[model samples]
Target chain A: MLSAGIDIGSRTIECVVIEDGAIREIRQAPTTFDPRGQIENVLAGVSFDRIMATGYGRNLFEVAYDAKTVTEIKAYGRGARHLFPEATTILDIGGQDSKCIILGPGGKVQRFEMNDRCAAGTGKFLEVMAEALNFSLEEFGPSALKAGKVLTINAMCTVFAESEVTSLISRGENREDIALGLHLAVVKRAAGMIRRLWPGGPIFFAGGVARNSCIQHLLEKDLQVPVIVPDNPQMVGALGAALLLEEGA
Target chain B: MFGLFGSATPNSNERYGMTIYDDHYLGGIEERVIRDTETARAAGAKVVGVYCAFTPKELIAAAGAIPVALCSGSDFPIPLAEQHLPRNLCALIKSSYGHAIGDSCPYFRATDLLIADATCDGKKKMFELLGRKRPLYLLQLPQTSATAESHAYWLGELRRIKVILEEETGTVITDDAIRKQIRLYNRLRTIVHEAFLLNTGPIPLLSGRELDTVTSVAGFELNLETRIAEITAALGEIKERDKDDDYIASVAGRPRILLTGCPTTNRKVLHLLEDCGGIVVAMESCGGLKTVGGLVPEQGDPLKNLAANYLSIPCACMTPNKARLDLLLAIIRDYRIDGVVELTWDGCHTYNVESFQVEECVQATGLPYLHVITDYSENDTGQLKTRIEAFLELLN
Candidate 1:
């Protein structure tokens, strides 16, 4: 049996196809203000026995296959359990938000902490910081590991943080050190969320931006846990959707 | 249909007083009320309490204190807030001066100490920001109370706040005292909640927005129980709209959205939302319960009752241990709400804290959320009209 999954996010979308528990095809796209056309394009050439949608915009569109949609959190948890059974805590950071999901011994999501109210500590936040430091998000996570001394980025507002970053820049601060400072500030925000949930782990980092070495390096250092990133972590939500289709199938 | 203000409407009855909602400006009503509220130095009302409707703040009365609604003092600015929070933080915080600490307004000289709580993140920081004053009491709340454990945790915190005030104010808070206050408060709350009830019930003399004024101002008076009793009776006499009036909505956001920076007087804004459909049967706002009055403290260690009432009502302000907006949303669910018109003020970071969370929650409730960014001033009709038309266009 063939199955298809669409993961609509606050800022991006992903679609995956699976046949009898084996992966077939997957495509990812930015969740724009107008993503329907792109969404249709991503789902192209993907004919399936069943179609399921999930995430913030899961219900926005109708697909050809029999419809079933779950929350992105639930899908992420289920997918994580299937991929990395030892992932006690699944920290999925998407475009507009980040969440800390605690899994029980049974691999079910027991307790979760999410910061969706503000865009202070997510991929978009990272993207803005990237622009401020004259680096790509691809360089954000690792750039921090090279820091000699860490500085604190004070502002939570993206605009304010940029200005702060600029002032520090004009002050002739070391670029790598400044990047480390920013990485710390954003990490502190996530750390606060994790501290609240108080999850036990081998924490799993799953999201497109999670691939960044700076976010990963700092997360592992500050958290004192092995922060594991899935191969193609961005597809975790959609992959979760696909796996759920298999389990029920 | 005629507005559910009063009986004998239109040109038919000249004596029919207008509902405050039938107004040219929100600040105009506030100005009128503030005008009624003589300055503390002039009023000579001994022992007043600054009321923020996060919880029952009547405890100050039990301590032989008077309750005052902590509105903006014309002369004061959020110096303390600016010290810690950004300059672009909301005006409510900027103007939260004097209320947290004494302000230039003479109304503050009467305040013995400020009582506050972290019902939300913003208010939590407000308490921290205001902590420089040292006399404030900040209460904390659980994020989710749906579970038995979380409920007990929050309720236990509420109980602890009662104890702390007993120690600080030296007001003996007995069970009888609290039970009595709770009964009176429960009555007031029920009545006030009923007024905003969307299920075709008798509209209380106030709406959620108006509750802020009634509750906050009425807390200061000595004869609160009597005043509330009289007001409750008056509210009963007011008319209830025949059918489900207009926009039945669920107002959601971070709890501490007090401090009215801008005054809104746009019925078209309300009407546009209504015409878009759904009478705004309920919402959470400072102009609502935070200032509006409710909860009659049972005549007792009046101080404890004051504190108790502050703990009960919901606030959009970020107060500790308070999801006042969340609680309000749960209460208003009986009205069968369809959408939410999140009327926001520009530069109001307080409400922005939970705006997105609120939108997501409303979507979970199977409703659309219309983010109507407006200032307290009701002059942005064209912008509001466009936004409302575009947003409402989605619901259709």
Candidate 2:
């Protein structure tokens, strides 16, 4: 059976096509304001028996495509468990929000916590700080590794953190240490959210932000647990949506 | 006077057509509140505004005063409150105090007397600020109901209020008058209980919003008989419609949720739950099914009975609120609840602290429980929807 899943996130749209329960093709593009048109363009040549949608803009395409909409939490959990069956806890830090999900036996969401209406510990927060430091988002993690001394960005608010970063630069502090401090701030906020629930067993990290090796390493150090990242962390939600097609959702 | 018959829903032409009730009869009561208060005021009746259900409404009624509730759930007064209290205080308290101090709420202006219960620390201080701007009475409630001493303390508080009421109205509160008011209020409680029991049906005869409106309106309406009649007639329509079991069977499969939380006078979460495949079968919030419906054992002494009835309400302010947990478990069984959703309003320390106990109680029954901590801000709508939807999927 051919099944497809599309994730219309705030920052990106990910399309995953599965054939006979195997991932056939994965594609991604920056999400446009017109999500339906963007999704159509991304999957122009792709065909599937059933289509499912999940993410911030999931509803925008649900009626247009006659697709079933699943919560990003559930979609990420399904995708993570399928990739790493032994994974019990999944932490997905996306553009606008971060989520910590505890998956129970039978892949059920036992419990979960999401960052409240703030962009403090999310990909957007890093994007803002990266812009302030004149570093590409992709270079943030690699540059932070060169720091000798550790620093902590106390303000989790993106705007406040950017000001704090500017002040650190004004004080002639090491740029690498400031970048590392910002990463630590994000990891600390993420750790605090994860601690609210029982964070037992292996932790799987997914989402667009999962590509940050600095965040991945800091999360492991702060949490005192090994973290696992999928081969394509960003496609987890779309992959999970495709997997749900067999369940007749 | 706002016209009642064939009244079009305000802003019905706008997006979301904000109707108070699906039933026209009960919806009429929303508009009738202002008119009813005006009529009572014109008839030389003193209007008493109450902050919480813990204040004995029957006592105020027995004093020949019309008792109306003054709690505001809208965000309009919140900015006004920020001028007085810090923005970090509980939303409900700020809303009430704001409406009173800002001079925006007609109910607050019309109230001849305002009784503010010291249910939590936030309100305890907020009411101090409110007293400066209005004719406010502060009732110090005991934090626990387990001991005889606390009950006696509460009983004395009620006696003190009765004297104050008598002084305000220049009329003595006789035992006969008290008993008469008790009987009438007891009848009103019976009707509220019947409406609550309607939720236990295969498909709830009343939506959480409708039930919340009726119960909250019960506190504000001076005429208990009229409100009782309207609710009973509305219940009749429901029974008539629910005679078809097919529709009930279809809706019965949805997850039955028991909502216990910070005073949710606003139906935002309740409507959202139903919108996301879960039906709120029971609520234990202030002015909700649990606090508003329980009878005041009419056989006992009127004063003691009223005290027991008020204190019997297990608010989060009380320590070791086992009665609340017991009541929650009983309703879970009676309503066949599939899950429990406990919502703690932002900065409400008492409810936030008590959520642990409520979670343990719900978990002991082997039911899934979701603890939603939120404020009145619209920013969390999508996040909350995702949580509720994911929870419903887990239930399935």
Candidate 3:
């Protein structure tokens, strides 16, 4: 039977459609304040035999869709295993939160550390940094790569990051390098999360920001490992939801 | 008030301007807050009666007790406590001479009875630390708004308060009495709510630094009705009066990130945030906001005011994380928050598992958030500043 997983995050809503146990399609959209409306909108073209929802807004959507809801930790664990089957630590970074999930060699979640209360290590921080730099996020990595020497990006808050970025810009620093500096700052933020969960490495990074080349290069450099992303990185959680539901069935 | 279970002595020690109790002991926290022989005297205070120095003595009147937070002698440094707690533990708990090897707060030393709330884990420990000194009237509160159980739990605690106060102090709490206190609190909350509302809300922001001075008054007796009146008046007078001056933050979990998890809120970190072009308008965890609701329980039953108060605030540990998130979210939304900083204390269970989940929720709003892990000691001030500046720079 076909199953689906819906992840309604704080700033994004994602859906994964699975057919015959192989992932079929995944879709994502900005999570609106009214997640119910956003969920309805994101799933307009999708049909499913069974549905499970997850994330911070999991319960809200469960009540709306009358669907089974699973924790993001469960969904992410399943999704990460599918994407990086041999990976031990699946670091899933979303818009507002980051999860450093530990997996046994069997790919089940052993322990996980979640940074949900702050935005420093997630996509939202990147967007804020991107806006501050006045460069499309597409420009972030390449520009950062060009920096001869990296200037320090102080201030972890998205609000203050913008001000600091503007100051850096006005200081006549190359915008690209500054963007790289911000990327490094986020990497540093992620590192703190990584250390706390103490997931021994060979880590796999996932999330929408995983598509960004700049972040990929920077992250790979930071961890000194070959970083990988799923074919459709955004739907990893949704895919896990469908997978988890199927397993239970 | 004099005949309520303990000895009452009206003799004031001239040097300290306190009613010295003859039986004051020096072995525990309770003995430090109050001593025997001075139960009715105003030298000692109940912890519950004072959430902050700025909370006002009217709260004491409403709660039917004197609000005396210990503020004497040295800043009691619990080597173990200081090892774990942020420098932000309420000034009263840290500043008093009470945490000595065997000494309790003289105010608690003198008092007949008292009340305290589990607003923070440290304060909860204070209940035990001081309880060893005296049986503290407990409020399992100052919790976050997420758990429905909190409301029920708090109302129950308040009910216990009503019964216990009635039995112990020989003064039963009536619904009318509670409603009367509620009205006063509501009025005060309204005023306080209004104070944060002035300047179109969340203006004239005080740093955690400046606000610490206000919280230092938490150690003062809540019966200083005059002080409450003075604060009310002073708040009204500031032209740049910012009703929304939320400076406290609860930074939870570990990783030695500066200024994260609940620090009992003090001037230093608040000063740090403000100095870094940031303001701690809200807490990412149960750190700063627990004191807001622990003042009175507001559940369906007025009798369990204490419990009700505890259950109403925002906490991260409860089942329904939404209510807790919403409470902090409302503060962020209301305070016009520019950014959020997460403090992860080194060895907390409930928060460490879900700290990132909390970080994700806040980040989803497109707000600026930073995560720091610390052992919550004051020793690593410089490294914390560098990280703070770096995090602030990220916002630019």
Kindly list the interface RMSD, in angstroms, of each predicted candidate in the order they appear.
13.3, 1.4, 13.9
Q: Give the per-residue lDDT digits (tens) of candidate 3, residues A1-249.
A: 888988877677888888767877778888877777788888897878889987777767766778876667667778888777787777788777777777765665555666534577588888878777777767766777787887788888888888988888888988877887888888887777777666456777787777677777877787787777777777778888898888872
Q: Model 1, chain B: what is the TM-score?
A: 0.61
Writing each residue's lDDT as its tens digit, candidate 2 over A1-249 gives 888999889889999999867988898988867777788789988878888999988877876877888999889988998999998889999999899999988988888888767778899999988888888998999999889999878999988888899899999998889999999999988888888775566579999889999999998988888889888999999999999876666
List runs of model 2 lying over 4 Å from the truth.
B1-24, B201-203, B217-219, B240-242
RMSD of each: 13.1, 3.8, 21.0
lDDT by residue for model 1 over A180-224, one digit each (tens)?
Answer: 887788788887778766655677888766787778877888889
For residues B1-396, write the lDDT of model 2, one tens digit per residue.
111101122221131222323345445654677787778779888888888879998899898888888888877789989998888888888888778887888778878878878899999898888778867888889989899999999999999999999999988998778889989988888877787788786667655655676677445666778777766766776565367564365355678888998888665677678777776767888866667568887775899999989987888888768888888988998888888999888889989998988888888888989988877767788778888888888788
For every model in order, the fraction of real contacts preserved is 0.00, 0.61, 0.00
Question: For model 3 chain B, where is the 10-residue window of minimal lDDT?
Answer: B1-10
Q: Top TM-score: which candidate number?
A: 2
Looking at chain B only, the TM-scores across the models are 0.61, 0.91, 0.64
What range of 10 consecutive residues in model 1 chain B has the weakest lDDT sum?
B249-258
Question: On TM-score, who's better, 1 or 3?
Answer: 1
- The numbered model that scores best in lDDT is 2
Report lDDT (Cα) of residue A88, candidate 3.
Answer: 77
Kindly state the number of residue pairs that clash in model 1: 77
List the candidate 1 regions with Cα displacement exceeding 4 Å.
Answer: A62-68, A245-249, B1-396
Give iRMSD, candidate 3.
13.9
Report, for all candidates in order, the number of backbone clashes: 77, 0, 119
Candidate 2 chain B lDDT trough over 10 residues, lowest sum: B1-10
lDDT of each: 0.58, 0.81, 0.56
